[model samples]
Target: MDESLSHNDEAHASSSHSGSRRGGWITFPFITGALVGLTLAAGGWLSNLIVFLIEEFHVKSIDAAQIANVVNGSSSFFPIIGAIVADSLFGSFSVISISSCISLLGIIVLALTAMLNSLRPQPCVVGSELCQPTSTLQDAVLYTGIALASIGLGGTRYTLATMGANQFDKPKNQASFFNWYFFTLYSTTAVALTVIVYIEDNAGWRWGFGLCVLTNIIGLAVFLSGTRFYNIDKPQGSPFVGLARVAVAAFQKRKLQLSSESKDYYDGHDGVKEGIVTGTLSNSFRFLNRAAQKIEGDIRSDGSIAKPWRLSTMQQVEDFKTIIRILPLWSTTIFLSTPLGVQSSMIVLQALSMDRHIGPHFKMPSGSVIVIVLLSTAISLTLIDRFLCPVWQKLTGRSPTPLQRIGLGHVLNVLSMALSALVESKRLKLAKANHLQPVVPMLALWLFPQLVLAGIGEAFHFPGQVALYYQEFPVSLRSTSTAMISLVIGIAFYLSTGVINLVQRVTGWLPNDINNGKLDNVYWMLVVVGVLNFGYYLVCAKLYKYRNVKGADVNSGSADSEK
Candidate 1:
């Protein structure tokens, strides 16, 4: 046993020495550049998709919005699957490399659709009474491009963040990387929203999509160039299988009594050596500890468990409990994200109906208007990291906990929804006074404050959630932890779609033309929902205890509460 531990120590020391020489901040530039290129490519096409569908495909405005929502949802949701694959089969490097290539292909296909007249419906004539619908072939080609792009995005986006974080050994460095990761992400998105959207609106759709293809190729190349500098982690087989084993073992031992003595539980090592876990089992969730309890004949002569379903290691048991404990807190984020998804989709429709002109020469593209959120988020992240965190540390003598940041975000989110409600009400009043014309006289800039507030809210919660999950989740599930936010966003977008559909069917809040509908009421409903969700989040935060808060300096007062 001593020899085995010494070998492990030597291997770890060697790995640390190698890591010091190759990885760390040295790899940041290449990874950051890759991230910027990928974001520019994705944001360019995704942001302008609704407009593309409406103008090129001749789809109805509402249908285009719904399609855009689905695409966004799919892009967000697929990361969970990608993360699982990275954890269980291929590591993040291989998955990211393959996914980037796939994205390049997808962008090329999309560019072809834009350049080829045969791939799209006939252009709608000005002042035409009716527009021709897209044929089956056109629809198939369009969907194929979208599917490929979404899958590619899902596989690469968050996985890259995980890989980048893995390169750094320190938790503080990992946290810093997350802030910069999001900042870079939003900054590139802002460029795409303004510059790329302008190109699409002015130069043409084909040029814009061609640029996406070019950027994707460049990004993939840059990422590949940094291969030697990255400290890549190996796939650790399936963590989910281990989790499942814990549950199965617990059930199989349901009839057996749980032992009070430390010697009675399996700890994934030699029975006489006291095993990996030296301490007494945590009394909380004692029911799950049954899985780790040892019974007669449960262990082989070699100290391996004879039946996998009848016994589990204490570490496995604790990992399962950690997931169970965090689930309620995790669930609150879904509702928080759902309303934002609804607002994002609905806001575009609002911008479409409002006066989009900033000057006689410059009419704002509706897609680019949403960039206000990204811009605000980028700026807010800088402020939070540079200013707010230091002030918080000075005043409180400790940094704000993840829960505190998330709570503040909840407040900001509710306020943003209320602001949106108010803005929409004024816009509706203006439209009603103008006799519900094709376009209202109100400037689309009126929407910026709500978007900015939402952005600030995101700056607070998004990274906080990422940090919380990455810290709390078991080491084996680190990639899965980072991808959890993507899963929440994806589910929320789908729920947003459902909520919008339900609202349209039950009330007059969302018509095909939002200007003719009670759009203000939708925002108000979101505000109400946000408030309720915030209340639920507070309850969960109050009850939840941090499993790994030591040395984190997470507002020691808050840490004390967990005790």
Candidate 2:
């Protein structure tokens, strides 16, 4: 299948190649520059946002973490909306361009909140008992800035990625583009985590946010400069609408008798269809097959759909079934990320009360501690792609399946939670010994092993989910497949927020001062959650069968061949 597709792409590229054409390697620098600048700008403010909320807004530590999680959820969730808008109304280029400007405006607003005294509560010393809480108006302004920034950042990032991938015809070129794109994204983000976050901690929030604003502007400018070089695809109506039609049609036709004859179904007009189901629908989910069963007024003289809500094509019905079959597996990933969300926030809080000093001169920012996870993920991803995968294939005679990878990730995540429990228990004991002092005697570096393990888990699961969705989803929904992972992550963050709130309400494990509470118990709870979630994943994996076996094989080949 891959050989055939490669031949087709080569033929298409050779015939289409011309100096006058818009897309190719020529647009790489401009697009990559825009990506770097925007990603750097996003990370600059977002990476240290919990610290900003705690220091500037006089919010409680737990509340700040919750707010940050909400912000992260919003950022992750909005991409699906952006992708929808791009597919249904505007093109990717327009959406990306407009979104970048919005990000610039949002960052400018953020910079103002940092610069102006009126937008936030008065600064108070850390751990002060008499710190003033923010007023309603102050909260509104701060939330407005965060909302805009989240919307803008979410709108552009993934849309820009799709646009970059669309620029090349060859799979290899598109694959290479993604490699560089992620490299730029992660590397620039690492810089922001370190350099930009250090500036925010040392120079001032105003300076850090000001740099974000500048980069947003530069990134927008660079993206716009590539106007003539991009291969812009026109908006096709949302594939989701088609899926909805299938569900509606299926329900409306629920009473209709099912049929096995090819002539009984609407195979579509002029042989134009969305899936491999040309003459018949799949036997599974036979109730939906009635959706394609011919009835009066279902089609017009031209063979186009007359009442689309009442009747769908065979392909649409099959496509809907494909999604239904894959949903359980997708659901298991939400819990996979929920624990990480909790850990991300909890680690920052832990770092704040631990020894962050190195050699007694340089104090690491609490925010910078998360960078260890990022670095660990990056390093682990490289090793998995370069070394581990090959070794596994050589020893096993086949590359690891996505389910295998995700299962490994689940086990690692559970182990990381257990490790986190141990670390926190030690810290809590030390805090008790010291009478719950502001800073414990424990070193912040003690958190690294758990974080590194969590990062490695992500290296396995996140990409595995993405690859799974892309391979399994119907052709019409291919563009939206990548966003499915984002949706999972977004839901995970929100679920984590809910979990934290529940723990706070029901248990004394989480309090205003974590040192005084049983934070280790929270990690132990998450470990249990992880263990249960992993069991659920295993069940789902055992029940699920690959819908696109050929595609999966190709993906495995690509993974194996990656050097």
Candidate 3:
């Protein structure tokens, strides 16, 4: 559980695991292969969910968009809980295995809904006054399937990423595994968007949902096959408990004078002398130093604290401080993700109304439009690693720090919003000209430019945020660190859902038929949001200091700038 002894633990694990010849590069294929299957299943159903709801459930377009956002929010949000459970109750392997089976059951339920007409409402003809509304019973059936699927998908994704990283000891090997992990994630989602969505659009919904079910089964199978080879970490109590204890102890001893001498503080267990390894207590967040300041009766005749809530180790207080310092930077990411959440649903609606033809005979599915973002991100990731980072290093004499990379992403995110507004303005004008038609005269491809920009922005920010959190967070919260991005994204999606509801109530910008509404105004609104967020991000980046500063790390220069 000690951060300083992580390498020693890994070394111990390696020697013990080596006897059985388990847990190294040997488990890589199975994990990555499982990630592929799981991601495919998730994207196949989730990506196409809005269309499915509107087409089969007799839900209104705007209502379906709201539902999609909510589902996406839940899917993003649940991973943190999954990570916590993995870290506190069960190991990653058990959590993933159980979650995968849950996902498979959920997908099977979804497939059943598509296959059985009785489970869904009567299909409504578009723009028809005689269409039947979905009954409460029908709605319940659909929601049950969605809730199950969302919970299942949420539990697996990031926990799987953490599990994959745990398989190796070397940072270099761990880094390589992450590269392949993300590549598989994006690439498999792309496959789902194109292949599975095409089947739903062309063949039958039943077939597409059935495919998801198959992939879920295969993913579970592949993951379970690798059980003998994983380096599973057992639960070491709740990390959050330590943080909470720091806050409680600080409050309880608020009246106590702060300590100046090193011996006054509790240096963790093992009876190691004070100031030997931990040095002195941090000066920042000085009020919290009371938590570590020893008082009579706080410690037993032995070294450990008698009342855990009244006193904490110096390391615990420092870990709590680390979270507080990084929070401002983390807040900036919610706004970054919020605009994309709104944009995602809006773009799908735009694609549904516009011309979707590809020359002679092919017509693109509305959901498949998101594949543009995925493909662009994957390509941009390659370009950033191969060309942009090197060019940046040459130009600046140092590699870009995580903050710098995230800053670039903010700029690009703002630009993407502006482009989205402009493209929507054009689409709206064309929609007015063809108001009587089912589809607008404009090509759906017109929306591609904005989507590609958003994708490029993600390529910069997503990994940057991941790296920043992983490097900056307390080692005890490693699983939680990766899930923090998901937490940001989840909140963003939920915020977007709230924003959409507010817009619906207040303005005519996002009507059921966007052809008659001012969706451009919505994009323009997001443009403003992005600009404000980017400014806030700049302020946070300016004031932020990197905690982890190895000589060869990209962040070392930025850390030095703080001096």
Q: Estimate TM-scores for all models.
A: 0.90, 0.94, 0.93
The numbered model that scores best in lDDT is 2
**Backbone clash total, candidate 1:** 0
For model 3, give the 10-residue run with minimal summed lDDT.
554-563
| Candidate 3 ranges with C-alpha deviation above 4 Å | 1-21, 125-127, 270-276, 551-563
- As a TM-score, model 3 comes out at 0.93
lDDT of 2 by residue, 66-163 (tens): 99999999999999999999999999988998888788878888898899998887777666688777889888778888888899999988888788
List clashing residue pairs in candidate 2: none
Instruction: Write one digit per residue (lDDT tens) for candidate 1, span 200-274.
Output: 999999999999998998899999889866777788777888899999988888888878888889888843222
Arranged by lDDT with the best first, the candidates are 2, 3, 1
lDDT scores of the candidates, listed in order? 0.84, 0.85, 0.84
RMSD of each: 4.8, 3.4, 4.1
- Clash-forming residue pairs, model 3: none
Q: Which 10-residue window in model 1 sums to the lowest lDDT?
A: 554-563
**RMSD value for candidate 3:** 4.1
